[model samples]
Target: MVDLDPEYVAARGVLLDALEALADHREAIVLVGAQAVYLQTVPLPGYQPYTTDADLAINPSLLGPRPGLEEAMRRAGFRLKDEDTGHPEPGIWEARIRVAQRRDDLVVPVDLIVPEAVAPPGGRRGARLAGEHGRRAARRATGLEGALVDHSLIEVGALDEGDSRRTTVNVAGLAALLVAKLHKIGDRADRPDRLTDKDAGDVLRLFMSATSQDMTQRLIDLLEDARSAGATRAAIDRLDPLFGTPRSLGTQMAVRALAGVLDPATVQATCRTFAAQVLAALGGAG
Candidate 1:
């Protein structure tokens, strides 16, 4: 494993406190997004960084009409930003936080994304694919809440998915999730403001590294389906550049040569371009 940056460690403490509060009502928190990436217990391919945010999928039902979550966060030295969209009722509810302190102008960003869907039946809250690491992390967070916090209303481990088929099935289901999320962008265009450049960059890098030809082909087929279904060309175009024609095994290896010469800035730029292509293809399909 690669060494983690010190900044990641500092920001993690703040995020842990925040997650501990959410875990107070463990069953109500559905873990998803990048936060789940760290819980996967494996480093994301080559990227070497500690995650600093907690992402959850709340049933939306569990969140009261007035947003009281902000108070819980405030106790931990985290102030809810007025711009947060997750909970806008009372003080503030944020899915993203920037550390108040900075070292060398680096302010760590912790993101807590809430997806529209809750866990399917028998799925663990906030984590479906997370194996041992996720369980361990969740337990640690729960313990912290119990020992240090007074969250009487919160419940921990309300649901367990020891036998959840959705999780135990295999890689096929995991691949399908990528496909599903690829398709999901269309349904989300109504909120044009929701699309961020950083989000596009992450998707591009993930798609570039995490997928195989078989998966890419499946994605292409889906894009074609979306286009036939009347998706927009502009939307499809944004997501198209992230990909090229399917690669041969040898070509895939050859591409790594560029990684040596390409700087981080270049890699990010390339990923962004590729992600735009992916978005475009998805849009055209819809």
Candidate 2:
């Protein structure tokens, strides 16, 4: 692993508090985004540093409206930030906190999401939770159903010295994380506003930090599971155009994200090799 950076430490600190706040509902929350990726990776020599907001997929059925979730988040130093979607109630909320007496406040965003497969069916952009006091409190996201099923407990804590709070939070398994990143890459192809090279870089990081055999097998296992099988199918379908070649858009995106920190040649080569290896292992099917 690389030396702990202050920014990453700050992000983890905020995440730690949120996890603790929702400790009772840990069963319903699965850590899903870049923060999860950063925690799981064993940094390579040229690992680029990137840590931001948190995303957690919740099983609303398990986190039923009672005792309230927003109240707990408010008690943990978070405030609700509605995205101005014109809904009378906004489902979005962001967690903010101070780490290590930093001069500026860290707006540690925690996006509470619901998998489209399990989210209450409606045309509303975000999912609703009665406990959040009529506000949506969660958004519906695709390809997250797999995350809810493919997760494991991880002991997590802040890196800031003297803050020794630790908790076992459920994070998406490697296979699921890879699948979600691929799903994001595919989903963003039409949404230029949300598309970024970061997700592609994240895919490369997963392939680079672990053995292809291990990753391939993990994905195969997920494919065998019912809850995540559809997501697995959708995820694998995106492999080729993304990383089939060094010149592929996904491969090039990964290379670009690491341009200054790693040799572009190394990033491109690794992405192509590993993407093909995983695809071959699964035979391009879920």
Candidate 3:
């Protein structure tokens, strides 16, 4: 609920309008990616110097199958970006929607992600929310109609400092997004191919930023166990860069262990030699 510029107000309106309109025929839509992160209040949502575009998750069935939806976005004033399809699986596709740019300290691009490649969240997590948060979000819920309803940018205003709802929205939103990311991982893994670097990086970024400390410790432990259990070299390689960088000692050790698996001979020899030197100075390998 950040206050937006007057000029960009109508642009945000238009983007909301399109999604609301699309939602009419679609079962459900969840905003995802950077926009979702910002909505979730991850430590660095708006921390980025500048960003363009908002990403949303929508079911393809809601869009009436393939290229028609892409044409729809074009009609709505979005310049769809065409990139080389990184994954060649039959059901994956993406369309980027850029509605407007704002002029403040820096220009930020607002993008709308068409949910083609990735599926939205499902089940009780997706079904409904609970407590005061559930009540408030429901009142604010645009359903499909609410999303289409226009409000002046000036009217939206900055989120009230006293309000707790923003945090609630962000926390719930982030939790759901993490589930989606995990799902995407499984989907890609089940295919003939492995998860892409982009997918892995996205998960790591979210994990470091949004997860609670206890959860973070658990992830570190899980990665350590995965390394010991003989996980794939690529998996261990991905975890290596996270260790000993500038974080906690526990994080450093986790990275060191994974690095060992990725380069066993070098890592083992170096670590063992280092350990032996220390042991000799004091007494042994215990």
Best by TM-score: 2
Give candidate 1's TM-score.
0.41
Worst 10 residues of 1 by lDDT: 141-150
Residue 259 miss distance in model 1 (angstroms): 4.2
Instruction: List the candidate 1 regions with Cα displacement exceeding 4 Å.
Output: 41-46, 50-54, 62-67, 82-286
Off by over 4 Å in 2: 1-5, 46-48, 83-91, 98-104, 130-135, 284-286
Q: Quote the positional error of residue 88 for candidate 2 in Å.
A: 8.0
lDDT per model, in order? 0.35, 0.77, 0.33
Candidate 3: tens digits of C-alpha lDDT, residues 123-186: 2222112221121111111011111111111111223233222111111133334334444444
Candidate order by decreasing lDDT = 2, 1, 3
lDDT of 2 by residue, 1-286 (tens): 5667676777777788788877778788899889888778866566655675788888877885554677777777676674444543344556656655579766767778888777776756667554553446667778877787778888877777868888888898888898899888888888868879888888887887789888888888877877677888888888888888888878888887877778888887888888888888887644
- How many angstroms is residue 271 displaced in model 3 relative to the true structure, after the best TM-score fit? 24
TM-score of 3: 0.35
Residue 198: error of model 2 in Å? 2.4
